[model samples]
Target: MGLAYIFLTSSWWQSAFNFLSLWLLDVPVNAYVTLFIVNGFIAPAILCWLYSFAMLLYEKIKNKILIPSIILFGAYEVLLIILLVFQPSLVGTVGENYIVSRSILTLIFTIVAILIALITGCILSYDALRSTVPEIKWKGRFLLIAFIFLTIGAILDSFSWTAIFLVIFIKIILIISVMSYYLGFFLPAKLADVLIKDIQ
Candidate 1:
């Protein structure tokens, strides 16, 4: 996911991609427009990340729905990849820093992707929060916060905001999301103990 951001937003990576496209395809790729191709991959990356969180939650609760959810998400990701490969233009167009989806198909896909993340987060957090186990509850708290931040950041990022401050703020929120997600799943035992003790 970080790599996707780097390639999509970083000027250096954009330049590299442009150069590659020009050399390979014998035409200059619009650096911003090229983000259409890059954005397609981002959705799949997000789904994969969400899946990891779901898997961890499943380990704690042993939910039967996780399997079906995985299959559905996998199919959705494959559909995105297929669309990207065959009809990238139908996905969307980028102007400045924001994207304007080209067709209803792309818009619907984007909405579905967001909903998938939200539903997964809600399920994991709700179940974990209900657990009598303190550790599970703590992880759930972080996961909930992470998802909230991520959703807000992603929405804000989709806009072509001219304000520099807005862009910075969005990036900060996204960074927080990543950090919170990491802690949710891989928190250190000692730190977790200390925090749980304080809360208790």
Candidate 2:
């Protein structure tokens, strides 16, 4: 769990680095492209790999939850890969053109991705809450709340730029909240003991 949290945080930091590149270097396009390649594409791939290993490590206890989570996560990764591949086209005109391409194919893929993420998140949250560990429960609740706000903000962003900024702000909050939760709750010996026991 600590390692997972660390990788997740690192991914977000890479995202922050991309943001900084855009803001400070006045190289928005290149920065965005680089960010997409590194943080957006590669980061999620790494996460999927880590999650898979974690699932394997605790298969006996977590299989019911983790198996489905892994499947959904895999779907999410495929969608993310597709998104990354077509990123330039998707964002070609501020996502307008792609919006216009809202045909069955696009809609199906979009829904698949959204559903997988939503399901995986819910399962993870449930697992966290049901754990005997109090710290893990709290961390789960924190992440649950963050994801809720992030979802709302993302929905709102579909309306206007103001909402887009709100999405960005919410994402930052989620990142901070997750990082803090990881450091405070999951990085200690307690979490390590729990994880080791789970694996065993």
Question: TM-scores of all models?
Answer: 0.66, 0.48
Best by TM-score: 1
- Best model number under lDDT: 1
Looking at candidate 1, the ten consecutive residues that score lowest on lDDT are: 4-13
lDDT, candidate 1, equals 0.62
Q: State in Å the error of residue 23, model 1.
A: 19
Off by over 4 Å in 2: 1-19, 22-25, 31-87, 94-111, 153-168, 180-200
* Model 2 C-alpha lDDT per residue in residues 53-139, reported as the tens digit of each score: 457345566666556756765675576557656663442222321111232333343344334444555566667778887667666
Q: How close is candidate 2 to the true structure, as a TM-score?
A: 0.48
Candidate 1 ranges with C-alpha deviation above 4 Å: 1-33, 46-88, 97-104
Residue-pair clashes per candidate:
0, 0
Model 2 scores worst on lDDT over the 10 consecutive residues at: 92-101
Scored by Cα lDDT, where does model 2 land?
0.48
